[model samples]
Target: MPYRKYSELAELVEMMSMAVTSGRFMNKLDDGTYYNLQDSYETFPVKKFENAKKSYAQGIEEDEELLFLFDITLFGSATDGMIITNKKIYFKDFLEDPECIDYVEIDKIIDRKISDEECEMTLCHKGKATKIKIPRFQFFDHHFIQFIAGYAEILQQNNHLLAQGKAVLKDGVDNITDIIFDAFWNGKKVEKIR
Candidate 1:
């Protein structure tokens, strides 16, 4: 049986290709008006995040780590934002307060094309649904987001297959010749296909 070790959440964030800037520079630009995920590394602005954290996250569980933070902001105003962590995810919007869910609790990741320029990702848990507007950063970034939406499922399947002595993850991983992201990326074919 094969197993992969996860040392930290940043590894997954990198897998998603999320553009996170250390707060040292971006903060001077935003002038620290708002906070981004804002970790110890100052991934974004952190000075204001403490307040937001108290209002929203209130600190995650001991073993949990924040993996991603996305907010739909226009001219610096945010209607909502989402935070993905090692164990679960949290969402907060104008309609409601912050909500959290475990990774395994996610039942499906539904993606829909809204138009030539827009698309949305929906996470369905049990019977309820939460929608996230995929940020258009580049030509193919959305696919990574789509994959991140199913991180739990992907890891589970890969580990399960490895436990069964299957090397699908290895084969795909070998195709990449990398130590990480073998299970998540499978191979470069995904990039060529898209």
Candidate 2:
């Protein structure tokens, strides 16, 4: 069988869409505040959050649509945002747009701290370190946090196996993909194999 590059991306989009639509997403806005997933969109005002508002207005422009998004703010100002598409994750700075990171580019999850009030995480990707702070109830309390890290590990494995051989890659990747899909779609427990 020939390697289908987009197959994994397509599968991921499906899995992530389930996570979003099922209300299993953890949404954190600016100001270190938390909202129930049900109230996620309420944080965005049309004039202030221009990009995010545009995304909402356009409505599913791609098959690889946005699964989850975070308005990354500094000192009560929305300067950047995190957008999770079906394929990759992006840290979009309003001043300059840089390339996003794929699963394979994510080196490791450096640190994660969850307190009663908020959660903070550090990730090293592509030799760059990034810090993310959000309310504990938004991310740490739900499975979406697990999905983000888990998907990266799985994607790294999938790419490695694909580089090995088509036959070997299919079996290894499908197994992991099935497990992850079931966890997100069927409410199955994900084995933290990595």
TM-score for all models, in order of appearance: 0.53, 0.54
Please tell me which predicted candidate would have the highest TM-score against the true structure.
2
Estimate the overall C-alpha local distance difference test score of candidate 1.
Answer: 0.48
Question: How far out, in Å, is residue 45 in model 1?
Answer: 2.8
Q: Each candidate: what lDDT?
A: 0.48, 0.51
Kindly report which residue stretches of model 1 are placed more than 4 angstroms away from their true locations once superposed. 1-15, 18-44, 73-79, 114-119, 139-141, 158-194
lDDT, candidate 1, 1-194, per-residue tens: 43433433234434443333323223222211223342444455453344345545665676555445555444443335556555666656556677776666677777655444444667788789877553443332354455555456644545466566774545532232232343333322222110
C-alpha RMSD by candidate, in order: 8.4, 8.1
Q: Model 1 RMSD to the real structure?
A: 8.4
Judged by lDDT, which candidate is best?
2
